[model samples]
Target: MSDPHEQTHIDSVGSYVKILLALLVATGVTTAVARLDLGAFNTVVALSIASVKMLLVALFFMHIRHSNKLTKLVVAGGLLWLAILLLLTMTDFATRGILGVPGK
Candidate 1:
Protein backbone atom coordinates (compact mmCIF):
# COMPACT_ATOMS: atom_id res chain seq x y z
CA MET A 1 0.00 0.00 0.00
CA SER A 2 1.15 3.51 -0.74
CA ASP A 3 1.95 5.90 2.07
CA PRO A 4 -0.83 8.43 2.71
CA HIS A 5 1.61 11.06 3.89
CA GLU A 6 3.55 11.19 0.66
CA GLN A 7 3.48 14.27 -1.49
CA THR A 8 1.29 13.94 -4.60
CA HIS A 9 1.97 17.20 -6.34
CA ILE A 10 3.60 16.75 -9.73
CA ASP A 11 4.48 19.76 -11.85
CA SER A 12 4.63 19.54 -15.63
CA VAL A 13 7.60 20.47 -17.77
CA GLY A 14 5.77 23.51 -19.13
CA SER A 15 5.33 24.86 -15.63
CA TYR A 16 9.02 24.45 -14.95
CA VAL A 17 9.80 26.21 -18.21
CA LYS A 18 7.53 29.06 -17.32
CA ILE A 19 9.17 29.43 -13.94
CA LEU A 20 12.60 29.38 -15.59
CA LEU A 21 11.61 32.11 -17.99
CA ALA A 22 10.20 34.19 -15.18
CA LEU A 23 13.40 33.83 -13.18
CA LEU A 24 15.40 34.87 -16.22
CA VAL A 25 13.24 37.91 -16.76
CA ALA A 26 13.53 38.87 -13.11
CA THR A 27 17.29 38.50 -13.32
CA GLY A 28 17.41 40.75 -16.37
CA VAL A 29 15.28 43.31 -14.60
CA THR A 30 17.54 43.16 -11.57
CA THR A 31 20.60 43.73 -13.73
CA ALA A 32 18.96 46.62 -15.54
CA VAL A 33 17.79 48.19 -12.32
CA ALA A 34 21.24 47.97 -10.78
CA ARG A 35 22.65 50.25 -13.46
CA LEU A 36 20.21 53.06 -12.70
CA ASP A 37 20.91 55.72 -10.07
CA LEU A 38 18.03 55.28 -7.63
CA GLY A 39 20.14 56.34 -4.64
CA ALA A 40 18.95 54.64 -1.41
CA PHE A 41 16.01 53.08 -3.22
CA ASN A 42 18.34 50.98 -5.32
CA THR A 43 19.01 48.54 -2.50
CA VAL A 44 15.33 48.41 -1.64
CA VAL A 45 14.34 47.66 -5.21
CA ALA A 46 17.04 45.06 -5.65
CA LEU A 47 16.10 43.29 -2.43
CA SER A 48 12.43 43.37 -3.37
CA ILE A 49 13.15 41.74 -6.71
CA ALA A 50 15.39 39.24 -5.04
CA SER A 51 12.68 38.37 -2.50
CA VAL A 52 10.22 37.70 -5.30
CA LYS A 53 12.72 35.49 -7.07
CA MET A 54 13.37 33.64 -3.84
CA LEU A 55 9.66 33.01 -3.32
CA LEU A 56 9.21 31.70 -6.84
CA VAL A 57 12.06 29.31 -6.42
CA ALA A 58 10.87 28.21 -3.01
CA LEU A 59 7.22 27.77 -3.90
CA PHE A 60 7.67 26.17 -7.30
CA PHE A 61 11.11 24.63 -7.60
CA MET A 62 11.20 23.48 -4.01
CA HIS A 63 7.57 22.33 -4.17
CA ILE A 64 6.79 24.21 -0.98
CA ARG A 65 3.52 25.49 -2.41
CA HIS A 66 1.97 22.01 -2.17
CA SER A 67 3.93 20.83 0.82
CA ASN A 68 2.28 19.49 3.95
CA LYS A 69 1.40 21.61 6.93
CA LEU A 70 4.40 20.42 8.91
CA THR A 71 6.70 21.42 6.08
CA LYS A 72 5.05 24.80 5.80
CA LEU A 73 5.36 25.32 9.52
CA VAL A 74 9.05 24.48 9.41
CA VAL A 75 9.58 26.94 6.61
CA ALA A 76 7.68 29.62 8.46
CA GLY A 77 9.69 29.01 11.58
CA GLY A 78 12.92 29.27 9.65
CA LEU A 79 11.81 32.56 8.16
CA LEU A 80 10.87 33.86 11.58
CA TRP A 81 14.25 32.92 12.94
CA LEU A 82 15.92 34.69 10.06
CA ALA A 83 13.86 37.77 10.68
CA ILE A 84 14.78 37.75 14.33
CA LEU A 85 18.44 37.47 13.53
CA LEU A 86 18.27 40.29 11.03
CA LEU A 87 16.40 42.44 13.50
CA LEU A 88 18.98 41.83 16.18
CA THR A 89 21.80 42.65 13.78
CA MET A 90 20.11 45.85 12.70
CA THR A 91 19.49 46.81 16.29
CA ASP A 92 23.14 46.32 17.11
CA PHE A 93 24.24 48.47 14.19
CA ALA A 94 21.68 51.15 14.99
CA THR A 95 22.88 51.36 18.58
CA ARG A 96 26.58 51.41 17.81
CA GLY A 97 26.63 55.21 17.63
CA ILE A 98 25.17 55.47 21.12
CA LEU A 99 28.29 53.98 22.64
CA GLY A 100 31.15 56.50 22.53
CA VAL A 101 34.62 55.37 21.53
CA PRO A 102 36.37 53.62 24.42
CA GLY A 103 39.45 55.84 24.46
CA LYS A 104 37.73 59.07 23.46
Candidate 2:
Protein backbone atom coordinates (compact mmCIF):
# COMPACT_ATOMS: atom_id res chain seq x y z
CA MET A 1 0.00 0.00 0.00
CA SER A 2 1.12 3.56 -0.54
CA ASP A 3 2.23 5.62 2.40
CA PRO A 4 -0.63 7.50 4.00
CA HIS A 5 1.60 10.56 4.55
CA GLU A 6 2.36 10.95 0.88
CA GLN A 7 1.13 14.16 -0.70
CA THR A 8 -1.83 13.67 -3.05
CA HIS A 9 -4.76 15.50 -4.68
CA ILE A 10 -2.62 17.95 -6.58
CA ASP A 11 -4.56 20.53 -8.61
CA SER A 12 -3.79 21.77 -12.13
CA VAL A 13 -2.83 25.20 -13.46
CA GLY A 14 -6.34 25.65 -14.90
CA SER A 15 -7.86 25.14 -11.48
CA TYR A 16 -5.70 27.90 -10.03
CA VAL A 17 -6.56 30.21 -12.87
CA LYS A 18 -10.27 29.55 -12.40
CA ILE A 19 -10.07 30.30 -8.71
CA LEU A 20 -8.15 33.49 -9.41
CA LEU A 21 -10.75 34.68 -11.88
CA ALA A 22 -13.55 33.87 -9.42
CA LEU A 23 -11.82 35.91 -6.70
CA LEU A 24 -11.40 38.86 -9.07
CA VAL A 25 -15.07 38.75 -10.02
CA ALA A 26 -16.16 38.59 -6.41
CA THR A 27 -14.02 41.66 -5.64
CA GLY A 28 -15.59 43.55 -8.49
CA VAL A 29 -19.08 42.66 -7.27
CA THR A 30 -18.18 43.89 -3.78
CA THR A 31 -16.97 47.22 -5.16
CA ALA A 32 -20.07 47.72 -7.24
CA VAL A 33 -22.38 46.83 -4.34
CA ALA A 34 -20.59 49.26 -2.05
CA ARG A 35 -21.69 52.17 -4.25
CA LEU A 36 -25.38 51.36 -3.75
CA ASP A 37 -27.70 52.65 -1.01
CA LEU A 38 -28.77 49.40 0.58
CA GLY A 39 -28.55 50.96 4.03
CA ALA A 40 -28.76 48.22 6.69
CA PHE A 41 -28.48 45.47 4.09
CA ASN A 42 -25.22 46.95 2.79
CA THR A 43 -23.18 45.43 5.61
CA VAL A 44 -24.81 42.05 5.02
CA VAL A 45 -24.03 42.08 1.33
CA ALA A 46 -20.43 43.15 1.83
CA LEU A 47 -19.87 40.50 4.46
CA SER A 48 -21.38 37.79 2.25
CA ILE A 49 -19.10 38.67 -0.62
CA ALA A 50 -16.10 38.84 1.67
CA SER A 51 -16.92 35.45 3.15
CA VAL A 52 -17.03 33.89 -0.32
CA LYS A 53 -13.67 35.38 -1.22
CA MET A 54 -12.20 34.22 2.08
CA LEU A 55 -13.43 30.67 1.50
CA LEU A 56 -11.94 30.55 -2.00
CA VAL A 57 -8.59 31.74 -0.74
CA ALA A 58 -8.60 29.38 2.20
CA LEU A 59 -9.66 26.31 0.23
CA PHE A 60 -7.43 26.90 -2.80
CA PHE A 61 -4.46 29.08 -1.86
CA MET A 62 -4.17 27.89 1.73
CA HIS A 63 -4.79 24.24 0.83
CA ILE A 64 -7.24 23.91 3.68
CA ARG A 65 -9.48 21.82 1.44
CA HIS A 66 -6.97 18.97 1.50
CA SER A 67 -5.78 19.44 5.07
CA ASN A 68 -6.35 16.96 7.87
CA LYS A 69 -9.24 17.09 10.33
CA LEU A 70 -7.00 18.49 13.07
CA THR A 71 -6.07 21.43 10.91
CA LYS A 72 -9.71 22.08 10.11
CA LEU A 73 -10.58 22.00 13.80
CA VAL A 74 -7.85 24.51 14.59
CA VAL A 75 -9.06 26.88 11.92
CA ALA A 76 -12.62 26.57 13.24
CA GLY A 77 -11.47 27.33 16.76
CA GLY A 78 -9.75 30.48 15.60
CA LEU A 79 -12.90 31.67 13.87
CA LEU A 80 -14.92 30.97 17.00
CA TRP A 81 -12.52 33.03 19.07
CA LEU A 82 -12.82 35.91 16.66
CA ALA A 83 -16.60 35.73 16.83
CA ILE A 84 -16.53 35.82 20.62
CA LEU A 85 -14.33 38.90 20.62
CA LEU A 86 -16.57 40.72 18.18
CA LEU A 87 -19.64 39.78 20.22
CA LEU A 88 -18.12 41.15 23.40
CA THR A 89 -17.15 44.43 21.73
CA MET A 90 -20.61 44.90 20.28
CA THR A 91 -22.22 44.09 23.59
CA ASP A 92 -20.07 46.66 25.38
CA PHE A 93 -21.01 49.35 22.89
CA ALA A 94 -24.69 48.49 22.92
CA THR A 95 -24.95 48.52 26.73
CA ARG A 96 -23.14 51.78 27.27
CA GLY A 97 -25.22 54.68 28.72
CA ILE A 98 -24.82 58.25 27.58
CA LEU A 99 -22.72 60.51 29.83
CA GLY A 100 -23.90 64.03 30.75
CA VAL A 101 -22.37 67.04 32.40
CA PRO A 102 -22.85 67.21 36.19
CA GLY A 103 -23.46 71.00 36.14
CA LYS A 104 -24.92 72.14 32.83
Candidate 3:
Protein backbone atom coordinates (compact mmCIF):
# COMPACT_ATOMS: atom_id res chain seq x y z
CA MET A 1 0.00 0.00 0.00
CA SER A 2 1.12 3.49 -0.71
CA ASP A 3 1.91 5.97 2.05
CA PRO A 4 -1.03 8.18 3.09
CA HIS A 5 1.18 11.25 3.29
CA GLU A 6 1.98 11.28 -0.44
CA GLN A 7 0.24 13.74 -2.70
CA THR A 8 -2.63 12.08 -4.47
CA HIS A 9 -3.47 14.64 -7.13
CA ILE A 10 -1.24 15.87 -9.89
CA ASP A 11 -3.14 18.12 -12.31
CA SER A 12 -2.09 18.05 -15.94
CA VAL A 13 -1.40 21.05 -18.17
CA GLY A 14 -4.45 20.33 -20.31
CA SER A 15 -6.75 20.94 -17.35
CA TYR A 16 -5.25 24.36 -16.75
CA VAL A 17 -5.64 25.19 -20.44
CA LYS A 18 -9.26 24.11 -20.28
CA ILE A 19 -9.88 26.31 -17.25
CA LEU A 20 -8.29 29.26 -19.09
CA LEU A 21 -10.60 28.67 -22.04
CA ALA A 22 -13.60 28.48 -19.72
CA LEU A 23 -12.62 31.78 -18.07
CA LEU A 24 -12.31 33.40 -21.50
CA VAL A 25 -15.73 32.09 -22.48
CA ALA A 26 -17.21 33.40 -19.22
CA THR A 27 -15.70 36.82 -19.91
CA GLY A 28 -17.22 36.85 -23.39
CA VAL A 29 -20.59 35.88 -21.96
CA THR A 30 -20.36 38.64 -19.36
CA THR A 31 -19.65 41.13 -22.10
CA ALA A 32 -22.53 39.87 -24.23
CA VAL A 33 -24.93 39.96 -21.29
CA ALA A 34 -23.95 43.53 -20.53
CA ARG A 35 -24.90 44.58 -24.06
CA LEU A 36 -28.53 43.47 -23.69
CA ASP A 37 -30.82 45.39 -21.37
CA LEU A 38 -32.50 42.98 -18.92
CA GLY A 39 -33.95 45.48 -16.52
CA ALA A 40 -32.92 44.85 -12.90
CA PHE A 41 -32.11 41.23 -13.68
CA ASN A 42 -29.04 42.40 -15.56
CA THR A 43 -27.13 42.83 -12.34
CA VAL A 44 -28.25 39.44 -11.08
CA VAL A 45 -27.19 37.63 -14.22
CA ALA A 46 -23.85 39.41 -14.40
CA LEU A 47 -23.05 38.72 -10.75
CA SER A 48 -24.04 35.07 -11.10
CA ILE A 49 -21.75 34.56 -14.04
CA ALA A 50 -18.95 36.40 -12.32
CA SER A 51 -19.38 34.27 -9.20
CA VAL A 52 -19.11 31.07 -11.23
CA LYS A 53 -15.97 32.30 -12.93
CA MET A 54 -14.49 33.29 -9.61
CA LEU A 55 -15.22 29.87 -8.14
CA LEU A 56 -13.57 28.14 -11.07
CA VAL A 57 -10.47 30.25 -10.77
CA ALA A 58 -10.33 29.80 -7.01
CA LEU A 59 -10.84 26.04 -7.09
CA PHE A 60 -8.68 25.05 -10.01
CA PHE A 61 -6.21 27.80 -10.76
CA MET A 62 -5.49 28.48 -7.09
CA HIS A 63 -5.27 24.77 -6.24
CA ILE A 64 -7.86 25.12 -3.50
CA ARG A 65 -9.43 21.87 -4.58
CA HIS A 66 -6.34 19.97 -3.53
CA SER A 67 -5.97 21.79 -0.24
CA ASN A 68 -6.66 20.31 3.22
CA LYS A 69 -9.97 20.60 5.04
CA LEU A 70 -8.72 23.39 7.29
CA THR A 71 -7.76 25.41 4.28
CA LYS A 72 -11.19 24.86 2.78
CA LEU A 73 -12.85 25.93 6.01
CA VAL A 74 -10.74 29.08 6.16
CA VAL A 75 -11.62 29.96 2.59
CA ALA A 76 -15.29 29.35 3.28
CA GLY A 77 -15.15 31.53 6.36
CA GLY A 78 -13.55 34.32 4.39
CA LEU A 79 -16.26 34.10 1.75
CA LEU A 80 -18.89 34.19 4.46
CA TRP A 81 -17.37 37.35 5.91
CA LEU A 82 -17.34 38.91 2.48
CA ALA A 83 -21.00 38.09 1.99
CA ILE A 84 -21.86 39.61 5.32
CA LEU A 85 -20.03 42.80 4.46
CA LEU A 86 -21.73 43.02 1.09
CA LEU A 87 -25.13 42.46 2.62
CA LEU A 88 -24.55 45.19 5.16
CA THR A 89 -23.39 47.61 2.49
CA MET A 90 -26.37 46.89 0.26
CA THR A 91 -28.77 47.25 3.14
CA ASP A 92 -27.32 50.64 4.02
CA PHE A 93 -27.51 51.82 0.42
CA ALA A 94 -31.05 50.62 -0.06
CA THR A 95 -32.32 52.33 3.08
CA ARG A 96 -30.65 55.70 2.46
CA GLY A 97 -33.78 57.34 1.01
CA ILE A 98 -36.02 56.05 3.80
CA LEU A 99 -34.53 58.34 6.43
CA GLY A 100 -36.08 61.82 6.47
CA VAL A 101 -34.01 64.97 6.89
CA PRO A 102 -34.78 67.23 9.88
CA GLY A 103 -35.01 70.30 7.63
CA LYS A 104 -37.53 68.68 5.32
Q: Number of the top candidate by TM-score?
A: 1
For all predicted structures, in order, the TM-scores are: 0.86, 0.85, 0.84
Question: What lDDT, from 0 to 1, does candidate 2 have?
Answer: 0.92
RMSD of each: 2.3, 3.3, 2.6
In candidate 1, stretches whose alpha carbon ends up further than 4 angstroms from where it belongs are 3-7, 98-104
Candidate 2 ranges beyond 4 A from true positions:
98-104
- Which is the better candidate, 1 or 3, if ranked by lDDT? 1
lDDT of 2 by residue, 4-101 (tens): 78567798999999999999999999999999999899999999999999999999999999988999999999999999999999997887666654
Residue-level lDDT of model 1, residues 1-104, one tens digit each, is: 65777848799999999999999999999999999999999999999999999999999999999998999999999999999999999999989989799898
Residue-level lDDT tens digits of model 3 in 1-104: 76687477889999999999999999999999999999999999999999999999999988899988999999999999999999999998989889797898
- 82 in model 3: Cα distance from truth in Å? 1.0
Full candidate order by lDDT, most accurate first: 1, 3, 2
Superposition error at 75 for model 3 (Å): 0.6
Q: What are the Cα lDDT values of the candidates? A: 0.95, 0.92, 0.93
